[model samples]
Target chain A: MHESASTQTNPSPRVQRAPQQPKTADAYVVTPAIDVYEGAEELRVFVDLPGVAADGLDLDLDKEVLTLTANRAARGRDRAVTYKRRFALPREVAAENVSAKLEDGVLLLTLPKRAALRPRSIKVTSG
Target chain B: MWSLLHNDTMKLFDAFERQFQDSLAVRRADTAISFLDNGDELVISADVPGMKQSEIEIMIEGEFVTLRAERKPGAFEGFKLSRAERGAQKLVRQIELPCRIDAEAVRAELKDGVLTVHLPKAEGAKPRRIPVKASA
Candidate 1:
């Protein structure tokens, strides 16, 4: 039977989690909703990953694919969730300038664009 | 049908869930919750990712409990949203507890996007200890 419309809304979301959780098989995966912004200097991604702490967060960028995993401590609840998601970046990223910040369960990723990809105004010099 | 199966075949239902984990991807939203009774109090815990504590409101009336919150949009002007699963969500929850709780004894905490509420059991609803003495 289907639950009521209100109850049917999916409520669980997480990233990478402890291996021991979901003992019978793979850890439960929750897909958090995200918002990606294309800025002049950087591409920013904001993800809502409640219940995940700083230590439980894992982020990796390989080639052009960015992968994020977060573990939310269930606190003795039934499921200790591990949320995972991957984003294929459209443009090259500046290797050293990429940054990340998390607060109040919201993860903010600042992906700086490569020198060539960033838009720059070229001055016209008349000789 | 819901009540019958949930009350009588809980173990079987749980087994079904366990069996499906390996083969399928389960989507969990922020509305999921757990209700527990430890005899002294009724504890409720839920997941509400990306929401700050300031955005949440809790209301208790008699045997009912309600949770309300709004998630602020993080995007700004001139920013294009490439992908979004939970773009911007609002939560409204109302449920009834089997046992009455003390309104003054309620306590709550929101951390790491998880919200936990503790409602102390009403004095009259608590089970009383029985005193047994040697028969004279």
Candidate 2:
């Protein structure tokens, strides 16, 4: 998923977020391209959702499943469509620790690893 | 002294050449787009995933219009990637507006990952309203 990240021009913007998820409606759905990276502390999932406004975006985490939806209103000369993607997280994620930001056309999600999941460096003690 | 200046010029030239290559990579890559003519205006829709509004460049010269944006790559040094698809690449696309347009009156917006541009026909080129009169 991340292979193309190197090949694509990234204009990722500084994010200002809408913490409140909006009321979602049924609309045309298109699957946005996504890149997922696993870090020591968190998982970074980047999704391309061009045309979706902050108010139209929604994120829901149910147990190990993550579903994101964002609607794009038809601007002055185009037709409206909805973007949706679902991921069943392989590892557990701390729901409270998750943070999301919509920048440029990409949705960047940081899902912090659960307490037990984070890799810890053990200190070497001379016995 | 002359060698120092020459080195500086060479460095600048190399930088410019890299920038040029980057733009060409984007231009040659296939990013999906649609162009529609609505009689009075030309509507363009492009999907520029992972790009910000400020990163986009829309240039119009005569009948040609160009779209450019980049999808920057994040640090992947030690992280393991689970799936492989899509790309983090510079995107460039171009299209002709059919007829000359009122460049100053053009409007564009980026929403979701889509860029839309509306270019209206030049004033003189717009079809004039004609009224039919009855002869008594």
Going through the candidates in order, what is chain B's TM-score?
Answer: 0.73, 0.67
Q: lDDT per residue, candidate 2, A27-85, as tens digits?
A: 45466666667666666777777667788788888775567877777654445666666
Shift of residue A62 alpha carbon in model 2, Å: 2.1
Candidate 1 C-alpha lDDT tens digits along B27-58: 54666778888788888887787777789999
Which is the leading candidate under lDDT?
1
User: How does candidate 1 fare on TM-score?
Assistant: 0.74
Over 4 Å off in model 2, which ranges?
A1-26, B1-32, B36-40, B104-107
**Most accurate candidate by DockQ:** 1
Angstrom error at residue A109, model 1:
1.1
Q: Candidate 2 at residue A91, lDDT?
A: 45
lDDT of 2 at B136: 88
Tell me the deviation in Å of residue B84 in model 2.
3.7
